[model samples]
Target: MRLEKQQITAGFIKQKTIEKGAALCGIAPIERFINAPHGFHPTDILPQCRSVIVFASPFPISTLSCNTNSPYTFVRNKMVEKTDQISFLLAVELEQEGILAVPIPCAEPYDYWDESRNHGRGILSLKHSAHLAGLGNLGKNTLLVNRTYGNMIWLGAVLVSAELEGDSIDMETLCPSGCTLCLDKCPQHALDGKTIDQKLCREKSISCTPGGGWVLSCNICRKICPANRVIKQNL
Candidate 1:
C-alpha cells in the first residue's frame, strides 16, 4: 500500500508538470544519486528528498539556424526562465499537497564557483538529474540527449520527500561510435568526450556586445552534433 501511494504521487507529479508546459517529465529515486558529487546531491539541497522530478522544454530549432546570435541567446534565456518557473510552481503545488518539495534553479546563482578554472556548477546538476530520471543519456558533448528531443531541451528539477518509483535508466548509447564531430568542431577544444573545459568554452561561447548585451557567440558543439539534428528531421 505504501508503494502504491508512492506510485500515485509520482504519477500526479509527472502529469502536473506536463500539464504545466513541460515537454517531458521523469522521476528518479534519491538512491540513484548515490554517485552524485559529495556536496551536490539532492539530499544536500533538501535533506528530506527521497526522489527527484526532472522535466524539460524543447529549445526552438528555428533559432539554431539564425545568422545572428541574438535569436539563440534570446531563446536560451527564455527557456531557462520558463523551466525555472515550471519547477517553482510544481514545488508549490506539491507543498500544498502536504509533500515537501524543493525546486532546483535551472541556471545561475549557484554556490559553487572556481574562479581559477572559470567553472561553475548548479546546486544540483540538472543534466545528470535528467539522466538519472531516465530522460536521456549524456552525449559526447556533455549534453543530455533525449531519444525524442535529442539535446535540444532545457532542464528543470524538483526534489521531493517521497520515495517514488524511478524511471529506468537509459543505458543505450546515443552517440554514434567513432563520432568526434563535437570534439573536433569545438573552436575552443573545450570538449574531451566525457567532460568539458568550462574555462575554454566560456571564453568563446559567451560574449558581450558593444552595447553591453550578452550573446551566446558560439555553439559549434551543439550545432554540429548528429544527435542534435535528429529533432529537426522529426519536426
Candidate 2:
C-alpha cells in the first residue's frame, strides 16, 4: 500500500505540473544523485528527501528567428518563469498531500562560487537533474538535449519525502559525434570538448543590468547546435 500511495502521488504531481505549463515531467530517486555536490543534494535542501521530481518546458524555436532581441529574451524569461511556477505549485500540492516538498529555482546560482575563478554553480544542477529523471541527455554543447525539444527547454525540480519509482536513464546518445559547430561558433571560444570556461562564457553570454533585467548577450552555441536545428525542422 505504501508503494501504491507513492505511485498515486507521483502521478498526481506529474499531471498537475503539465496543467501548470510543464512540457515534460519525470521522477528520480535521491540516490540517483549521490555524486552531486554535497550542498546541492536533495537531502541538503530537505533532510527527508526520498525522490526528485524534475520537469521541463520547451522554448519556442520560432522566437529565435526574429531579429528583435525582445522575442528571444521574452521567450527565455517566460519559459524559466513558467517552469519555476510549476515547481512551486507542485511543492505546495505535495505538502497538502502530507508529503514534505522543496522546490528548486529554475535560474540563479546559489550553491557554490569560486571568487578567484569567477565561477558559480547552481544550488541544484537543473540540467543534470532533468537528465537523471530521464527527461533528456547532455548534448555535446553541454545543454540538456530533450528527445522531443532538443536543447530548447527550461528545467526545474522538486524534492519530496515520497519514495516514488524513478525513471530509467536514457541510453541513446542524442548528439551527432564529430560535430563541433557549438565549439566553433562560440564567440569567446568558451567551450572546450568536455567543459566550458565559465569566465569566458559569462563575459560573452551574460550582460549586466542596465535598467533592471539582465540580458543573454550571446547564444551562438545554442543556435548552432545541430540537434537544436533538427528539433526545429521537425517541429
Candidate 3:
C-alpha cells in the first residue's frame, strides 16, 4: 500500500509538471544520490527529502540561430526563470497536499563561489539530478542530452518528502563516437570532454558592452554541437 501511494504520487507530480509547461519530468529516489557531493544532496537541502523531482523546458532553437547574442541571452534568462517558477508552483502544490517539498533554484543566487577558480555551484546540481532521474545522459560537452530534446533544454528540480518510485537511469550513450566538435570549436578551450573549465568558459562567454548592457558573448560550444541542432530537424 505504501508503494502504491508512492507510485500514485510520482505520477501526479510528473503530470503536474508537464501541465505546468515543462517539456519533461522525472523522479529519482534519495538512494540514487548516495554519491552526490557532500552538502549538495537532496537531504542536505531538505532533511526529509526522499525523492528528487527533475523537470526541463526546451530552449528556443530559433534563438540559437540568431546572428546577435541578445536573443539567445534573453531567452536563456527567461528559461531559467520559467523553470524556477514551475518548481516553485509544484512545491507549493505538493505542500498543500501534506507533502513537504522544496524548490531548488534553476540557476543563480547560489552560496558557493570559488573566486580563484571562477566556479559557482548550484544548491543542487540540476544536471546531475536530471541524469539520475533518467531524463537523459550527460554528453561530452557536460550538458544533459535528452533522447528527444537533445541538449536544448533548461533544468529545474524539487525535493519531496515522499519516497516516490524512481525512474530508470538512461544507459544509452547519446554522443557520437569520436566527435569532438564542441571541444575543438571552443574559443576558450574550456571543455576537456568530461568537464568544463568554468573560469575559461566565463572569460569568453560573458561580457559587458560599452553601454553597460550584459551580453552572453559566446556560445560556440553549444551552437556548434551537432546534438544541440538535432531538435530543430525533428521539429
Candidate 4:
C-alpha cells in the first residue's frame, strides 16, 4: 500500500543517508523551508514539495588549522559534491521501489554577499531551518549548533512528492541563548552575535588573499566555532 511504503521510505532514506555519511537527518515541510533567508528564497517552490528530508555530514575538528585552508576553506563546496552524490543515490533507490524522491540542489554557488547585489543568495540563514528539521540550533558563531555533532556539519535537503509528517525542533530550548564563543574565535570579526556585517566580513576576509580585498573565501567564523569541539566525524 502507498501508506505502508511511505513509512518505509523514511527508514530507507535514513539508512542511505547515514550509509552515505550523514551525521544527522530530519524532515520538514517545504512551507517551513522557504521562510528561511540564510541561503536563498524558496517561496516560489510548489506545495507539491510535501516533505523536505534534511541531512548533515560531519566535518573534521582535529584536522583544522590555518595552513589547512585548502580543505577547510573549500569545505562548503566540497560538501556539495558529496551531498549531491548521496542524494541522487537515494533518489534512485527510492524510485526503484515506487517511492518518489527528488534531490533538491544546494543553494547557488557564488560570492553570495557581494556588495553590488545587496542580495546574498547562498548564505541564507538556514540554521533555524536545520533546527526546525531537528538538525540543530544556531551556534555562538551563528552556525547550526548540534550538541553531539558540533559545528562540523554540512546540510542537504530532499523535496519529496511523498506526503510525510514534518518534524520541528525548538532551537531556543536547546542552545544556551547567549553564548558568544564563535564571535571570539572569528579573526575577521564577521560575526557580532546573530547579526553579521557582511561588508566588514568580506573586507577582512579578502585581505588574506593576493588580490586587494577580493578573491577566494576566508571562512574564519565557520571554521572556528566551539560547537565543533566534540566533532566525531572527519571531513
Collision count for each candidate, in order: 0, 0, 0, 7
Name the TM-score of candidate 4. 0.74
Model 4 lDDT at residue 76: 53
lDDT of 2 by residue, 1-235 (tens): 2234445566777887898888899998988998887687878788898999999887888876776566687788887788778888888877877788899988875568897777888888888888899997887678998778888888899988988888888867788877888888888888886788888888877775667877777788887777776677776
Candidate 4 or 3, higher lDDT: 3
lDDT of 2 at 84: 79
Most accurate candidate by TM-score: 1
| Regions more than 4 Å wrong, model 2 | 1-7, 208-213
Q: After superposition, how far is residue 132 of candidate 3 from its true place, in Å?
A: 0.4
Q: How well is each residue in 1-235 modelled by candidate 4, as lDDT tens digits?
A: 2335646555666776788777788876666765565435333343455666778887655446646445554665677788878777766766665666766555555435556724364432346557767787775566677777777777776656776666667545333556566677666677777667666666655445454332345666665555565653443
Clashing pairs in 1: none
Model 3 per-residue lDDT tens digits across residues 200-225: 99999999988889989997877777
Q: Which candidate leads the pack in lDDT?
A: 1
Positional deviation of 224 in candidate 4, in angstroms? 3.9
Q: Candidate 1: what lDDT?
A: 0.90
Go through the candidates in order and give each one's C-alpha lDDT: 0.90, 0.82, 0.88, 0.63
- C-alpha RMSD values across all candidates: 2.4, 2.6, 2.4, 4.4
My TM-score estimates for the predictions, one after another, are 0.96, 0.91, 0.95, 0.74
lDDT order of candidates, best first?
Answer: 1, 3, 2, 4
